[model samples]
Target chain A: MTEHVEAKSATLADELLGVVQAVEGVSAVYPAQPLWQSVAGAAVAAVTGEQLPLISLTEQDGTLAIKARIGVGSPLPAPKVAREAAAAIRRHLGNVPAVVEVLVAKIEA
Target chain B: MKTPGDALECGHSLAELSAYLDTGEIADPAHLDSCPECQAGLASLRRLSELGNELLTADVAEAGSGGDDWMQTILDNLRLELRPGRSIPLRAEDPQDTLWETEGSVSALIRSVADSFPGTAAGKCRLLGDITEPGAGITVDVEIAVVYGHAMEERAAALRNELAKMLQVQTELDIQAINITVTDVLELPAPAMTPNTEDQP
Candidate 1:
């Protein structure tokens, strides 16, 4: 991917991350990609001097695939939190054709 | 802390997390609060700490003093793994949007329920079934320890009722059973262990 595309993706990832974090039940947002991806992404970001967001954004087959891993706290169940987060992301996406996934990786104590 | 790969995805080490638990100090406290990896690590470490204390209490009670290898054994067994656990599918409004909850989170929720009891502490929890499939039949197996004075049967029954209600509200799984196993009965002063006659032989 070109620097412009990567930068744009990172920017959007950061935006979506903000949206997810603003959700009522989400207490934390984790780096959602695989370990190898995180390492490689860090390396790539270092060489290119770009800010790599924790949320993963990959363009596949012309569809922007976004994954956000989050931790939800009490007063709201995880399923509700995950759905709300995904819906918030979708609402932000608007007309953009993309696949959004949310994982409730931790339930807070 | 013993391994090179002890670092979390967010570039924080488990040792650092352990320190945060002990000293309540980290390079970036705000980051620890916002970072899911650190939060997960802290939650896990907290659970381990509670269980470890209970173990040490048991050890001290049995050995008359816990200056023994049992603590070493616990540390050796610390092979801590990030608790993403099994992923259970969730209903999504959009066809393309996928959402799921980790088994670790569910386990944490269940353990919290158990720990809320006056004289109970939660042990390991298992969600036995195809959690990846929505509405799949599953059995929740929770191991717990109760204070010596608490009635074991009553505690287990109350825990069962609470877990069923909580799981029904929190998860979408078709919970076939919520099994509460009272693995240990904790006594403030462990009963004196009789001398091992077999050791004499």
Candidate 2:
């Protein structure tokens, strides 16, 4: 049950990642997790045959918290892009409560 | 053709990009335009190259030749560190959802703004404050070099004001100050029209 829930959480985060990428002014999505987690995720994925997400999903105080790092394009304010991306993720979450964190890792202008 | 770029994460590196910028000899020119990683790498490498040129020009103009290894050293160090610095928080739609931007991205935006001014090339940029904390009073410290003939004070002042406004639009950091340091006086590069005059790759 725990493994199942964890996989489901990762999938949901990956789905939101796709949604954020589709948002306007977002140019690229980078790995939000630290190098250690990235390596661990890659290893676990190798065994489970699951495609891991670049973003991170954590359970904090009974809340599903998702973190994303992305690059924004020029001519559009990065703050605007980050807000739009976060909004898209929240809209996707719908009635299912989630804490979406969007980080603009780069501005590719 | 297949140069071993740094870590091969994108099959491209700053070193390879730097060589291409100098020699115009990439095995596949099409790759540069289509590959997003190469394009990103090129943008950063190009800007750094411009700054390197400024330093070298200043050296050549002042004494004689810029024969020292300083330029190479700078390039080596820069290529190693393309950090996406501190994550500065931004206001989100709800208290749960969070928004933020990295200091590196802000620096890139700042460099682009500085480039708009004539005869100015930006170098190291830093946000000196606890950017992770919301509404922190942040100071933007940027280094730039200008052509010998241009007015450094006017250009720096203009860049400072422009950076301030851009930061407000792009971030919520409190208005502390934007400090522009004139690092060196550069000699103007030769016209690009003479590229054909040089030996072809």
Candidate 3:
């Protein structure tokens, strides 16, 4: 039983990695970064007391960005969340060539 | 037992009933009557729809308002980077060393700091002039979104003061002037409790 559970966890992590790799302009998307994991967790916790879904941040040419598929898209022109997330990473890292991408894979069904 | 989304199978189909609700065009309208299953399914769907609306209301309530501390806390934790678009170079002691920051980085920092304030959020920010050249005249222009309840003039005034202080402390850019514009007004959340006067029984 313990072995089975471990396999399942590994499979889920792989699935998450696969999703991150699929987004456009994403050179690399791996497990959470130390800076982002701590800070993003705090930001999410402010809205929801519960722990948040794992969000991945990416970097592009000294610009940081986040990728999240939240499924709620309003039909209006506004600031893209992906760019905003990238901006957040840039703000934290100070012109580092790193982008933060937030992937919201699952929601409570 | 009738669950919320469960369809009643009174020798009829759930799909047909669902279609009827949307288009009012069912193949056999006469079969709906005298069919206990069909009636039960319709009632169940109706109840579920009502409950869904209630749930939506509750969710919006839970999201809270811009004035709420949850948003403030999130903005505070973000510690957003500034959006420095172009690298402005400054003369340094060594010719090999380069002193410059991107426009994207500076803008992001300005936004995050602006968003930290209650009833205020930052938008697009621009730096006018050749920042790469040392001693060049530079102007900081920023757009902001303010929550509806707060006075626009008051919010803008507060934002200017805060931005000036933050820029002076954080960056070494040659900022000649700081311009702020309130571009959007966020809707305020509804009051917590609505009056109910039917407790006389």
Each model's lDDT comes to: 0.74, 0.69, 0.46
Runs in model 2 lying further than 4 Å from the true structure: A1-11, A34-37, A42-51, A59-62, B1-42, B50-81, B116-118, B188-201
Compute the TM-score of each model's chain A versus the native chain A and list the values: 0.84, 0.79, 0.31
Stretches off by above 4 angstroms in model 3 are A1-109, B1-84, B189-201
Instruction: For candidate 2, list the clashing residue pairs, or say none.
Output: none
List where candidate 1 sits over 4 angstroms from the true fold.
A34-37, A42-51, B1-20, B23-38, B44-82, B190-201
Model 2 Cα lDDT, one tens digit per residue, A1-109: 3989977887887787789889888887766763334677657755795545667778767777888878788678888888888888778878767788888767754
- Candidate 1's residue-wise lDDT over B49-105, tens digit each? 775576566553343323433333322223223445677899998999899887767
Candidate with maximal TM-score:
1
Candidate 2, B116: how far from true, in Å? 4.6
Docking verdict class for candidate 2: acceptable
For model 3, how does the per-residue alpha-carbon lDDT over B21-54 read when each residue is reduced to its tens digit?
Answer: 7688876565454232344345434433443344
What are the models' TM-scores?
0.77, 0.71, 0.36
lDDT of 2 by residue, B93-125 (tens): 788877877666676677667755665666666
Question: Candidate 1 chain A vs. true chain A: TM-score?
Answer: 0.84
Instruction: For each candidate, give the interface RMSD after superposing the true interface residues on Cα.
Output: 2.8, 4.0, 20.9
Error of 1 at B192 (Å): 11
